[model samples]
Target: MRKKKCTMSIPTIIECFQMGMTSNEIALQANVTARYINSVLQQHNVERQPHSSWLRRYTVNENYFKTWSASMAYVLGFFAADGCLPKDLQLVSFSQKDPKILEDIREELQSTHPIKTNPRTGVHLLNISSKIMKEDLMKLHGMSPKKSTILEFPYVPEEYLSHFVRGFFDGDGNINYKKRTVSFVGGSQTFMEHLKKRLERYSFEPFIVSKEKYHRLFLSGRKTVYHFGQWIYKDKNLYIERKHLEFNREKLPPDQIKDRPFKAHKSAIEARKLKLLYYYNLYRDFPEACKSANIGINTFYRWISTDEEFQLKFNSICNEKKI
Candidate 1:
């Protein structure tokens, strides 16, 4: 007697993700542990199929994109209103998802005229920046930020900006260049300020909002008058852009890039952790790729072990895709 094979389908997992269903939900309905579901889905290559059909068939809610803003992508809406970039907000597209924050940003765009909007989704999102100063903006750019809103910070500092750039604003070429040198090229102090004020709806951290101004006054040598970013003199054309950063070990946060702890299988997840450490250091380690995942490193490994599905899914991305 041949029993039926309960092979998990890619569309099913994607449907669950699209319907904004959590791992637990998917696990329950699929009659498989969420971890196993993630594992199978990861193995299935939906991308190998036509994207348009895949998306149309999947039909995810537009607002569902906001989940990318949360650490673990609050499937249960634990931090819906507060969906700014979490420590682990990596692994998802951040800049592309910036538009999702527009509904949350509407309060700040108080212009009498029709508020400007981006072409792709018609959502007017602020350009990401770290050097802009809040007070300097109101005085310089003629912007009128809403004083009453709880999301008061109008800027993201250099350190915080790095996280988004590397994690979210990613680019091609294996290594995430956008995140590595995450920075803006133009803007007045005021422009940066207004931009900051609007991004509060997203998960951008406020304390990590202003660094250029503080550095100018105390750390740097030049007399940089601008508050938010640097004052550049290119071809005698005086303008400003946010400064780029180095990839030195000291430059990165003391720990590995923080974000929500993703779950996966013990063996597969461990393999990934080892790979992550290897890649992170291999750039300079000049050593061969290590074999085992770092056990004590990220706590998320346990979650991955328990959830078979996530382990499967993360495996697709956990390896040396960039390398």
Candidate 2:
């Protein structure tokens, strides 16, 4: 009897090949002869590896996350910010707009897993489908399938804390050279608070502001931003290039550095006051404004009575609305 001809598309055949399926396996699944599958793979310049070799095509150090090293801490931190674990899959995936960072991470992890691009968003994705890796991430690092909102700061060793923070910063933090600010945004309030506490140990007075669904920890002004750059990049070689370059650019003049006496800093206080004023203007009611701004009613009243500048600004805004 004659064999059925290969009916699978070229892309499907290539995909199966890339997925570590042997030609015979693809042929069997597609209901075609093995020779037909081999020809299709050859036409696409895809090599036909033995079944055992194909199974080992994508190799990684499964024990990479088990020990605490600079690379391990950094990868863990980055994962906490950007990695995702599917509820039904034994996989951990990372998506980044910059493929360079993903490439760096893959190299650091010694992973040969292919990095695929999302055509729709032009994002690069690296998915490691290993049960051991997934289990280690969950059991060792306290990672969950959907960990954004409930993520707690992991216990990174003191010596490797900077590396961990830098990794997390590379994933979720931003630096504004023009504004002279460094900020971290995270979905978990607990995580942000813990991060803020850790940064405080380095003399960074970061302030946390609650957003609608997440929290933002911010360090503003020239002195803090410059020092932050120095702190996170100290003795660290693994970092996102663009951000590192931006941070290493010319330092601002000493005269431009403002003194920060309070923990919240002058800029943060001004930002909070502005946020309160914005809410007040939106609602035109003091109590409602306080609620929306996430500030206590007592705090609003105290700001009005204690700070002459804030009080004047509030009065001006209220007068402008009346007119």
User: Highest lDDT, which number?
Assistant: 2
Model 2 residue 247 distance off true place after TM-score fit, in angstroms: 1.4
Residues forming the 10-long window of minimal summed lDDT in candidate 2: 47-56
List, residue by residue over 197-280, the lDDT tens digit for candidate 1: 433434332111222331000111011111111211112111111122222212334344433232422333433443444343
lDDT score, candidate 1:
0.31
Runs off by more than 4 Å, candidate 2 = 1-56, 252-269, 272-323
Query: Model-by-model lDDT, in order?
Result: 0.31, 0.80
Model 2 residue 79 CA deviation in Å: 0.5
How many collisions per candidate?
32, 0
Q: What TM-score, computed on C-alpha atoms, does each candidate reach?
A: 0.20, 0.68
Error of 2 at 165 (Å): 0.7
Candidate 1 regions off by >4 Å? 1-100, 109-113, 116-323
lDDT of 2 at 322: 90
The pairs that clash in candidate 2 are none
lDDT of 2: 0.80
